[model samples]
Target chain A: MTKPLSTEVDALSARHPGVIDRPLTQRFLPFAVAFVLIAYVFGSLASFDVVRVLSGTRTDLVNLFFLDSYAYKVHAVRKLESPEFVLSLEGSRYAVYDERPAWLAVTGEETDIDLGSDGRVHIKGDTLEYYPKDEEVAYKIKFGPGLVPQLVEGVAPDWMRASDIQVDMRPSLFARIWITKSKIEIHRYFLGWENFWFDFDSPLNGKSFGEIASLAVSGERMDPAMANWQYIFFQFWNNQEWQHGEVYYALLQTVIMALVGTLVAGIIALPLAFAAAANINPVGVARFGIRRFFDFLRGIDTLIWSLIFIRAFGLGPLSGIFAIFFTDTGALGKLFSEAIENADRKQAEGIQATGASSIQKYRFGIFPQIMPVFISQLLYYMESNTRSATVIGALGAGGIGLKLLETMRTRQDWENTAYIIALIILVVIIMDNMSGWLRRKLIEGSN
Target chain B: MSAQVTLTQNPRLREIGDAYERLSRSRSLYTVLLIVVCAVIIIGGFMVADEANSGSFWGGLSSFFDYPADIITGTYAAGWGWFALVWSYLPFLVETINIAVLSTIIGFALGALLSFVASRNLVRNKLIVFCMRRVMDICRAFPELVIALVLVLSLGPTPLAAVIAVAFHTIGALAKLFSEVNENADMKPVDGLKSVGATWGQQMRFGVLPQVLPNFLSYGLLRLEINVRASAILGFVGAGGLGAELKKVVDWNYAADISAIIVLLVAAVIGIDYLSGWARRALIGKTGTI
Candidate 1:
């Protein structure tokens, strides 16, 4: 999109009606050629594989997807010294397993009974010991019997491995490994979508596929059917707890990289912009050299610069920042110099007639005219750089992209990948708003 | 009179002189930026120097620049490998081309419709234009990668999903441009068509569209080239393209392959660039500017 200039179609057309020159052939030949080539390519796809393009990708996906690539370390809880028993999982209460403590000497129902902290309740007929201390870590038990067999039968790639299971009320960044006698079975599904992997670990390996699968499946709803306008509102009307957190650290890294990079580059670019401008250097050769210098540096894409930086500095956030800074310097210099070139000559002339020096003329005349454009350009650069940082980070320069890459490629965490995307969108909105605000301020301030 | 003529006649001399004086005046700003640029160039120089120092890399690299020296002159058949390379790039190229072509077409098609809504002379509702523009703005604000990710989440990771995402952006950008073109178009034909009881669609069909079609085509061709580049980029988000292949090589640290891929990519870019230029020139005819 371009800023509209004052040239009117009315006046031009008024002078001539068929002014567009009716020669469609000369003007549309290339478009026709392009169209033909594109058509040919698509038409030929049925017969072609081109080394079966994206085959390795599919193989990689197959390898990484599902539970075959996963391992778990879990300890069975019932085998340990604890009284936490599984409950009816379908939001119900089943038969209670009770025991009387050995030292209690006596036990009774007080309606609201608090079995002493250090004591265990012993059942009259059963040998099971009910430790109230352990019972406080209550877990939902299931009445249903067949959860695992159903899942394994449902999908061949699907597997249910139950291991060390701690029943921590809260979840951590990664699914935690079990400790001591607590056992956990993870319901991990690997899907091709965003390299998706989800794990539902619990203290109980509830009876069948339905009981466990219900817990896992019921968490997040990603069905495409929900995207329809009629259904979209219904789906989000009650935002599930599964809608993961945004504004994580990786996003912050990307934002910081863009801001710090462009600003640093701007600070470094102001002088070069002046030198490159045709107005500044009287010697044509020197001016030409400065101009070419800016071009040569900027011609290299930002991502390539990032790759180079990574190689030079080794893998880290530092390399990413350096890449952004280096590329922005050259690019911003070119933009700033162009702004300078397009400044009003009259203002500079006015300064010249006053017997002002070179620096004085630029300070008084050039700066005032070009500052607004400079800020506008700066705003654009900052906006563009946010996305660039994500790309560079994917190359292992450390950012949200690194998180995204690892999860997708190795961990196969599609849901988390979705969460990462949401975070990126949020940042983009924030950046857009910030750019708009800054542009308005710079324009108003200059005015 | 003579001094005035000299000043006017030698605009170049006056421009440079004035520029020099201005530079001298803004010494601090210019000096600082100068130092930064010099440092950047130095760093870039260092990278080149470092590359040169790698004996094998330089040797291979130097050999690469030799024009057709190792062309398979004999009856040596590199058929399958060559086929593999072409195949590897084929779908990617197709996807990229598809993204470019479809995006431009959809953008151009919908842009015309938006321009109709946005024309002040044709439509007087400021609120509608504002809402429409804002919607377009939001669409354009998103990078294609972000769009691909979101679509992959909502719609699944199909090529159709990618096409939709990119097309969404193209619609936004093209709509805005289309509105501008419509706004600047002559109102005489539109007024006459309206006076004759022509509907809004008819007026647009005959009155305004003819005036802006050439410019629209030119912009669309330019957008096509951009889409090709963008399609390549969407590979980073699993949208599927040449970028995915390039990414694999980079991740594997296959430096030779990386270099070759980049060369291919840049060559593709240049090819697209020239093709777009030809298209633009064709659209513009002998005009000085599009």
Candidate 2:
């Protein structure tokens, strides 16, 4: 029975070769496409230096971005020539030194620093001494007329890196010191953003959260002119380093840009969509022209649009909004016209059979059919435009994107960059959920 | 007329009439309220944005076409040189396209793997699925520009930075889409293969891939279109591409040069859109017409 069946299958294949076997092109087309795609990808990646990126060196950069975005550095600089000591955070000059910090002390002719586990360092005029923790021998360097520091006593420990002009020492991950001929600088690292709540000038800068809370509740004022909570709020809002107030306002501008841009685009596109829709507008040329116009609008990238608008509007959220409006008009018009074209013909016919006027037919017949699609599409674009607004803002349209670009340009304010990024993501996610919920409600409601 | 009088007199008919009126009224009321709320938000938001903007809306509106007019005049004056300018910028256009292509390829491969893990129908472990979904979410949440900008800081404004950033984002987007596609797939083939002593990988490769490959390819082609736009935009933020060239001309106020780049970019985008749209339709519309 099996042999007979096999012979029958062979006969069938012989009778209908096309049905049993695929053509050579069909068999090899996918493989050919895959080969081309792979070749293009690899060629491009090689040309773009993917190897250098995938190499171990980039991990350092990745770590730097991750670490610097979360941590703040405090620097202590003592100018040898002027003989003055200043401690600052994140290399800012706004150091308040009415009195010395506990870790650093200065007497008449000498300065001493407690370098945590690396032991203490005592510096006298023209003489530098390092006392290694848990060790008796102290390494000493005497600063003289020459750039080099003459080793006065003891063997140099591993922590000491003495060069011609500068003596550098890194005791731990959190602390380092650079003693040069011109100045002695010590950097101590700490987790989290420093002066995030208040600037160095604010009296409340060094206070912990618990301390600030107590200060707020104790009926005592951190600032003599205001209540404690008000002072804290003022300091936080007016934080010199972070600028929480300005950042929040920029975020608000971004949100508003998306909202206004999307709504305005929808409004402007509604009539144009009707003109462009084949079934709604009987004139072929007008419909074709309008369709092409929509295409032209969408074809120009939003970045280019914003750049053009920036020149006219002079770098602000308005330009960003206009860019979004223009680009989205083309997009929404295309989408809306398609929705209009796909509207049920039976509904329009039913309305027309009632002896309704054209305007009334459109109002009662077409509008209801496309309303759900129009609304859901609008909401979806609104959410997406929030992201586009951000990108536009970076191109000099005033919003969080511009603010982010500003922080990023500085290169040192990774913490602020991180903060802004987090906020943008949070807002985007919120917008996403909000638009989803609205789409569900509107679509269901329409039915 | 007597039936109408009877309808008015009957308690049940009266109750139903009143209930219908109340329901319709409430529905219309909700609609009116929604419209009012939306109007207020839009109007108020416009005012706030306008106030925050450096230029007033009315003032900007008056001069909205000035820049475009300038660019047009500049391009016209340049005459035949504008074509040369476009020709010169073609390489930058190619670079931008390359960035998109490489990133999309990388994204497609990674996203396919991630989507498999993320799909509830394919993956038995709920925890793994949950974690993978969250991973995609976080990846998607980060805008490409943010990542590209940061990477450029570390990597020194290379196309690789843009590629990685865009590819990272594409992974999340494609995975989400692919997983949704995965959920709707038939399980009989998978079960049959599994019963035949096929390995898990074998079962997925033989039973599921053939079913979902077309949709995956279609979605991937769609992503390629998006990524092309994305990579061009990323170039504006110092990633290497036509956008970077446009940024240069824009900064220098070279109107003719800017228009040339804009033309190239628009042409490229539209051409890609058309090509990809056709390809996608073919892929989905015809089963054997590779």
Q: In candidate 2 chain B, where is summed lDDT lowest over 10 consecutive residues?
A: B281-290
Best by DockQ: 2
* DockQ agreement of candidate 2 with the native complex: 0.63
- Cα lDDT tens digits, model 1, B1-290, are 99767866898978977898787778667658856864674454334323322223333334442312222321024444544555566566666666566666666667667767866666878888778778777776565665566454444444544566677878876777778888889999989999989998899888998898888878887677667666666665666566667778667755444554555565666577668778888888854244
* TM per candidate: 0.56, 0.89
* Tens-place lDDT digits, model 2, residues A237-289: 99888899999999999998899888989989999999999998999999999
Looking at model 1, give its docking quality level. incorrect
Residue range B1-290, candidate 2, lDDT tens digits: 99778779999998888899999999899989988987987889888877887888788878988999998999999999899999999999999999998899999999999998899999899999999999988777778888888888777768888899999989998998899889989999999999879998998898889999999999999899889888999998888998899888988988899899999999998999889889887889843321
- Lowest summed lDDT across 10 adjacent residues in model 1 chain A is found at A149-158
Tell me how large the interface RMSD of candidate 2 is. 2.0
- Tell me the tens digit of each residue's lDDT in model 1 across A192-293: 231122112212222254644553445444345553332333322322322222225456666666766777788788998888888776678877887666
Calculate DockQ per candidate and list them: 0.08, 0.63
TM-score of 1: 0.56
For each candidate, what is chain B's TM-score?
Answer: 0.69, 0.94
RMSD of 1: 16.0
